[model samples]
Target chain A: MKKYLYIIKTTFNDSIQYISSLFIRFIGFAITMSILLSLWTFIYQDNTTISGYTLKEMFWYLLLTETITFGSKSPVATNEVKNCIKSGNIAYQINKPYHYIIYSITKYFADTLIRFIAFTIISTILGLIYVGPINNISIISFISCIPVFLLAVLITGMIKILISLTSFWVEDSQPFQMIYSKIILIFGIFFPIEMFPKIIGNILRYTPIYSVSYGPAKLMLSYNFSFFLNILITQIITIIIISIIINIVYRRGVRKLNVNGG
Target chain B: MLTEVKNNLKIMFLSLKYNLIRVMENRVSFLTSVSMMIFNNASFIIQWLTIFTLVEYIGSYTLNDIMLFWAISSGSYGLANILFNGANKIPEYIENGKLDAYLVMPKNVLCHVITSSTEPSAWGDLIYGYIALIIFNFSIKNIFLYSLLIIIGALIYTSFVIICNSFTFYFIRFSETSEILKDIFINGSIYPDVIFNRAIKIIFFTLIPCALASWVPVHLIIEFNIYHFILLILATNILIIIAFFLFYQGLKRYTSSNLMEARS
Candidate 1:
């Protein structure tokens, strides 16, 4: 635990040096959100709400969803595992003091926490500038959503590790990761599940996309106790399932591992 | 001038052939990458399709119109990426002094630089583009227009990318910013032209030039106007010429550190 804390601190310090990249990404996200705002504005010109979201809620919802996404874009942390496994760079860590996945997760969380904070602040400010404050949202509901949001980010990270672990079997697992992210992006980040057909929406709720991107944002905008309970439980279950899968995959992968290095 | 043009094209083709061969050496990775990219691109269609289901038209675009827009954008992107993936890599090349090799050669610097690399997964994009074209709308004239405008689109797309990447010379470590600009260009291409108001639309047309690769081409597909076609061609050519000018000017500032590197 101490070493993991050290890893987090080191990774956090390392991430701060590249602060300009955050600025650039914020600019990109802000531009994309502005475009979405325009589309939503055009959308709401005739209608009061979209997918049960008012225009104001739509902006803030999109903002929160995208912020979670921004926080989860730790591809370097994810890709490093795949590359190290494939390149046999993991051989050096065979006898490391700390557990590999735990160390990696700590690093990923530390790195992305900066991005999450940056994305949330900038996007919230932009959301205010674009759509004004969410008059209908309660402070309690908003605060309550934070744990679920962080868990969502963690679930996303674990799932990525699960995908990355496939390098033990496949020639390259990066493509699967790409496709998975796109699935999450389209189903989770871009729209509320309410936008989808009823069957698809229900099916998506059973998947990790809802937990990773949508559930928290939805609960924030319009807090419902039952709804929050369901999403939170779904998220907790997802984290458990993915963690078990990662442990299983990692164990099986290590059994097949062959490394030749001094 | 004609002979010079012919010689440049010859070398460009040779470089492209070799680049393809090199990437294909790992056939499984190559195949997987291409197939994965196709699926990756195809997955993007669901968003717009879902939007269309709720709203009959997004701006002036219909359901079919949106599909056609995607076809144009994807095909254009695929073409630019496959043949001139190096446009995106210009910064890395310049940063690493890999541009030094191209300079010593007698070929057109920008031409050779861009064609010296290829992205095999872009073949997926190219294939997906044609697949989308066939699925969305198919006719002899439509095919002809697609082929022509796809080239126009690819040219416009590559030109702006090169122009974005050429900023490596003016600003040290400008690679990330160039990458962000390139992302904006590619990502913005899917949206309809009507979405942007006058101010931003002007920037999209002039600075980003994303519309040339997508909305304009899709619009022409819907209703081919000779005047619009001519202006599109004109704008694309001007962009390419500007790309050439900027590249050469930046080339003047390039200084190689004599680092050891090899390319097969």
Candidate 2:
């Protein structure tokens, strides 16, 4: 655990210099999100409620959804690979002591930390001044739920790595990356998966992505012990499955790499 | 000037052809990107449709008016996406010293840079926007006039984007500027110009020129305003000329050190 913390801290320190640009982006993100949410708020003004929730509840739903969604890091594995491929720079990395996936995971950890801080700052400011606190979850639940949320981020990054590795076999990985990211955005963004159509939503609820997004969100916003436990179990199993698949793909990718030329 | 224009047009087509071939080489990636773009645009259309179903209009515009506006805005957006996405990466290229290769090319350095990274996905957005326009309640009576106006609108929008990208010469670091420009187009142009007061409308039309991209053309197309159409065409020509001049001027200032260090 100490070694892991040291690695994470080193990664975070390396990325801290780039945090200023993210601050600018976060401001723009906050303003746009606020306006979009406020529009929904206005639209729901005439109605008493939507799907058995009040306007404030709906606003909270949008805010919390936006927060968690923003917390989700950009899928950068494909991008990193593309840059390496374009510049023929992967050879240098292949010789490095650390594994590629571990390096990527570290980078994403640093990236996600930046995202979390930027988003937390933005949301906290907005929540204090413009809107109020979202929900009143118990302190114990809030504290305990942090690790589950971090695990969710880990799975998300792993999923990105798996998709990016497909670039090894495929000609262009960007489109796939864009599509998968969009899926993450839509299903994970404005509303929880449960708010989706009943049958599809129920299925999505059991999936790894649901645990990554909705589970953590619900735990933070509203304490649901049973749902949380179910999500934890599902996440553990899903991680194993995803890890096996990733390992297989990674080996194949290394075999197929045009390392000699580029 | 006429010969230069013809040569540039030829180069543009050649570059576009080359890009198309390169993109097609990566079939799966190209198709996936295209499909995702189509889906993204379709999602917007559906959202607009749901809103229209719930409400008669956003402000004074009817459902048809709103759809028409979205159609023009989205289509212009598609053209802009194709043309300037490469230029948008200027910062990265400059910082990474990738601009070196383009500078060594025989053809126009700017054109080469712009053509190297065409987003084939934009075609999906273009198709969706066009389909929306065709399905909308607009009369088919002025099809030729509307088509001409939209073409001019696309040209003007493309020119403005070129000008925005040329700012890499002076600003050098333009992340904030680019973000603000994107926000201006995305938020300001989606709705009708009339929704804004006359002052803001004038500002959008003249300063930002987003009105030419969507609002002015859509309005003139619907109302059959010959004067607005003529004005839009004239503005398009002027903007294109200015864009070309500024691009060349900026190119002159693009020194080795700037190319090496600038983040654009």
Candidate 3:
């Protein structure tokens, strides 16, 4: 645990070295948000609540979802895992005294923590600039956003890691993460699941996209104990299932490499 | 002059053919990459589909109009990348001294630098564009128009990217800024033109040139207008000329990194 804590500190420091990249990412974020806001404003030219969300709620909802997409460090995990497996560095890491899973997840958490903070602050400022404030929210709603956001980040990292671990079997696994990200973006990030057609929205409710993006944004906008518990349960179960799959994949990959470099 | 143009075209095609062969060496990777890109592009349509369900028209842009936007945007972007994918690597090359290899070549520096590589994922986008066009606005005339406009749009997009990337030659600070500019330009095209007011439209037309790349082309295809067509041609030529000017001027300022590099 102490070693993991040290890893977190070091990773955090490394992430700060490249602050310009974060600013560049924020510009992209701001552009997308502006586009979305413009479209939403045009859509809601008269109507206030289309799908149980007012324009303010919609804007804040999008802010949180976009945060999940950009701030979670999913793509970094995908690339790191892919490169590690491709370059045969996983062999050395697995044989080391440290646990690779802990090491990698800790690194992701630390890196994402920095980005999450940066994005949250920037998104909050943008949100305020766009919409006055998110409505229909109590202090509990704000409090509930915390756990779900952390879980969303974790869910995203785990899913990306799972997709990238398939590098052992597939000739290419990089695109699968893109597919997963697009799923989350379309279903949960750009708009709430409620905004989707009924059948599709109902179906998406059971997917990781719901847990990873919609859950946090929804909880942030409106806090219901049952909804919070439901998302929490889903996130926990998802983590467990994905962790088991990742272990199986790593074991199989190790056997294939025969504990040797690729 | 015509002979020089023809020779360069021939060389570019030969390079593309070889690059295609190289990418296909790993058949599985090629297939997966192409399929993934198609799926990735398709997912955005789902988002717009959800929007269309809620509203009949977003600024006179119906489902078909949005499809046209996607078709042109994807098709044009793919065409540009397929031919000049190395434009995406200008910053990296400039940073790492890899531009040295291209500088010593006998070819035109900008052309050689751009055509030296191909983007495998762009094939999926090109196919997806055709699929969208056939499904949405299928006509012999429209197909011809779409093809012509896609080429025009590709030229505009390529020039825009080149202009953004050329700044890297002047200052390293532009490396990330260029990337962000490219992202904004590309992302701007995925949405409907109607959502943007006149001010935003002006910005897209002048600064990013996404309107020229997507909205204007799609509008021309939907309804042929000779004036807009002429304006489009004039603007594309102007943009291309500007891009060439900036790149050559910046090239004069470029200092070699002196690090040995080779293209495998």
Clashing pairs in 3: none
Across all models, the iRMS values in order are: 1.4, 3.8, 1.2
lDDT of each: 0.85, 0.68, 0.85
Provide the TM-score for each candidate, comma-separated: 0.96, 0.76, 0.95
Report how far residue A164 has shifted in candidate 2, in Å.
Answer: 1.6
Q: Name the candidate that leads on TM-score.
A: 1
Model 3 ranges with Cα > 4 A deviation: A74-76, A136-140, A259-262
Candidate 1 stretches with Cα past 4 Å from truth are none
Write candidate 1's Cα lDDT for B76-172 as tens digits: 9889888998898899899898887888888898998899789888889888888888887878898889988989999999999899888898898
Q: How close to the true structure is residue B259 of candidate 3, measured as C-alpha lDDT?
A: 84
User: What is the C-alpha lDDT profile of model 2 across B36-87, one tens digit per residue?
Assistant: 7877765655445545544455667776777777777777777666654575
Model 2 per-residue lDDT tens digits across residues A1-262: 4544666788677667777767666766665565555555555646675555555555555555566557655545557765664454756776776776677776777667767666766766765565566567677886777677677777877887788777777666666667666666666655555456678678887677676777776666667778778778878888899889988987887777776662
Ranking by TM-score: 1, 3, 2
DockQ of 1: 0.68
lDDT of 3 at A82: 85
Supply every candidate's count of residue pairs whose N, Cα or C atoms clash at under 3 angstroms.
Answer: 0, 1, 0
Task: Output the better candidate (2/3) by DockQ.
Answer: 3
